[model samples]
Target: MTILLMLVQIIVLFVLVMLHVAYATYFERKIIGHMQVRLGPMQVGWHGLLQPIADGIKSFFKEDIIPEQADRPTFMAAPIICLVAMMTSLAVLPFAKGWVLADINIGLLFIFAMSSLASYGVVLAGWASNSKFSFLGGLRSMAQVISYEIAMGLSLVGVMLMSGSLNLTQIVEAQGNSILGMYLLPQCIGFFVFFISMLAETNRVPFDLPEAETELVSGYCTEYSGMRYAIFFMAEYIGMMVMAAIGTVCFLGGWNGPFAVPFFPPLWFLLKIYLFMFIFIWIRATLPRYRYDQLMDLGWKLLIPLALVNIVVTACLKAMIG
Candidate 1:
């Protein structure tokens, strides 16, 4: 029975994640469409509710293409690697009390490690494609991912310091009793750094230089098509959801609400995630893509230093309090 229950939970979580990824694409299109003064996807279903399903079906049936010179094995493995890495990060996120896939002590570090692994997929995909644009995209992805990852990891140190544990649940618990209960308030600087880094980590605009359509013709996945391309897309969206979930867990107090309003904590969590997703879409619509040089400079010069400062301040406060 215990094993059966665990299987059920895994199935449910898998379905939920996939549904979220599918709808996220639809949501992005609708939001961006409205921003540009156009009605989006009303033809598929009401407000294009069925659009994602149609897209999934179309991609599955479409011809899978490989460039003549492409390395077939690595090319196929790349998207799977990307998707799996992102999904693995979700295991440690606590949706509500007693509602996590793995309640391990090193949950935070596990997530960070898994997130870092995702870059390999981009790098491999680009290299395997044997295209100049793909190669350049892969190079950019590697540099950008590593640069932002430093800031991203450093930003979380502040949370770890205050929470006194690497466990994500403990981090959320630590926020429950303070005047500025949520880490978002006291660690505002860290939150800012992490939030910006989240955009970079997920390769969302204006940091989407890896797939900058105009310059690199879809970036690292330039040679991909059909379901292979869809896997890349799925991985991208799942990465976005993971980043949003991390933001909710680390900074916003995952499943923490004002009162135990029965059946509402998950709702709160979802709301926070959607809010971040909206910001992601909003920024994409409002900001033009950053130049490659400018993006690199911002990550290295601005975000990294800010994240370091946040860690320093947080550590000092913890020491003084102790």
Candidate 2:
């Protein structure tokens, strides 16, 4: 009975996440369009509300193309690997107190592990496609994820130090006890580093060299088409939401707002997540892509070193406060 209940929960969350993934693209297009002072998706439905539904149908019916010489198995499996890994991270996130799918002590670490695993999908997709552009993009992405991932992980050490636990729920509670009611005030350094790393981790603006259309044409998944192509994009957006959720939990006081909704307590949680998503779209609209060399240098020569310093400083402060 317990197992069956858990399975039902998983299915529901997965469906909700897929719906969010679809609407996120619509939101991005509309946000970017408005940013550029143009009407976005007006023809689809009432300011493009139903655009995501149309897109879902279109992608479902589109032809699935594969390179004649491509490694069919790996090519087919890559997007599924990437998408599944990302969606799994949502399991441990605390939407509200005790509302998590899995309330484990090492939930934070599980998320980090899943994120690392997602990189393998990118690597395989590029190699299996057998295109030079795809291969180079994949290699670049592998290196990019590896480099910035170090910075991102190290930056979060501060949050762990303050919370005194790897459980994300405890982290939010820790922020609540703080006078400012958010780690954003005290963990400013970590927050800054984490946000920078988040953008790079998600292959968002200023760090999207892997898919820079001017150079790589389409990056690691360049050979994918139709639903397979849609899957890769779904993974990207879901990955964005996951990172934003982490930021919310770690820095923005996950679900800890000024007031709680009487009947809908998770309202605050959803609002914070949406705010972070908007920022993701905002940056993509505003910033130019970083050059590959500059991107690497930022990760290695700057963010990592800064992350290291933040860890040391955070640890010292926590020790002193106690």
Candidate 3:
């Protein structure tokens, strides 16, 4: 009975996430459209509210194409690998007190591992495509993720040290213990580094070298079409959501707010996640993509060192205060 209940919960969560991922596209387009001084999607439904549903239907029925020269098995598997890893990371997130799919002790580490695994999908997609553009994009993604992942990991070390636990829920509770009710102030440097790394990790504007259309013709996904392509797209959005959730949990005080609603405990958590999402779209509309060299330099030269320093400083301060 317990296993069955868990399975049911997993199913429900999966459906909800899928729905969120679909609407996330609509919201991103609408948000960016408005930012650029234009109406986004007004065709599908009232104010284009149904656009995401329409897109899902179209992508589902669209022809799935495979190149003759492409490695058929691996090409088909890459997107699945990517999507699975991102979805798996959601299990450990504590939506609110007592609201989590997996309340494991090493929840944070589990998320990190899944994130790293998702990169394999991109690399595989690039290689299996048998195209130079895809290859370059994959190579770029590999290097970028590797570089930024290091910074991201190091940046969170402060949170780990302060919280003294790897569980996501405990981390949030630790923030609740803080005078500010958040680590945003004390771990400001870590947050800064983490924020930048989050952008790079999700391949957002200025750091989307992996899929730079101008040079690599959509990067590693140029060859994908229909549902396969849609899967990759969904994975990207889910990745964004996951990163937002992480930032919310680690720095913004997960699910903590000025006031609590009796019916909706996860309300604050959802709002913070959307706040991160909005910033993502806002930046996309505002900033130009960085040159590949500049992206690498920023990740390796700037962010990494900053993360390292933040860790050391946090350790020293923790010791002094203790």
Q: Give the per-residue lDDT digits (tens) of candidate 3, residues 260-303.
A: 87998999999999999999989999999999889889999999
Model 3 stretches with alpha carbons more than 4 Å out: none
lDDT of 1 at 57: 97
Candidates ranked, most accurate by TM-score first? 3, 2, 1
lDDT of 2 by residue, 1-322 (tens): 9999999999988888889998999989999999999878888888889999998999999999999989999999999999999999998999988889988999889988999999999999999999999999999999999898999999999999888999999999988888668989888889898999999999898889888889999999889999999999999999999999999999988887898788877788889999999999999999988888899999999998998999999888778887
Model 1 C-alpha RMSD vs. true structure (Å) is 1.1
Candidate 1, position 58, lDDT: 100
Off by over 4 Å in 2: none
Candidate 1, residues 1-322, lDDT tens digits: the string is 9889988999999998999989999989999999999988899988799999999999999999999999999999999999899988888989887789899999989988988889999999999999999999999999999999999999999888888899988888888876555888888999999998999999998899998998899889999999999998988898898889889988888877766657555877888899999999999999988998998899899988998898888888878988
Deviation (Å) of 109 in candidate 2 = 1.0
Greater-TM-score candidate between 1 and 3: 3
Worst 10 residues of 3 by lDDT: 173-182
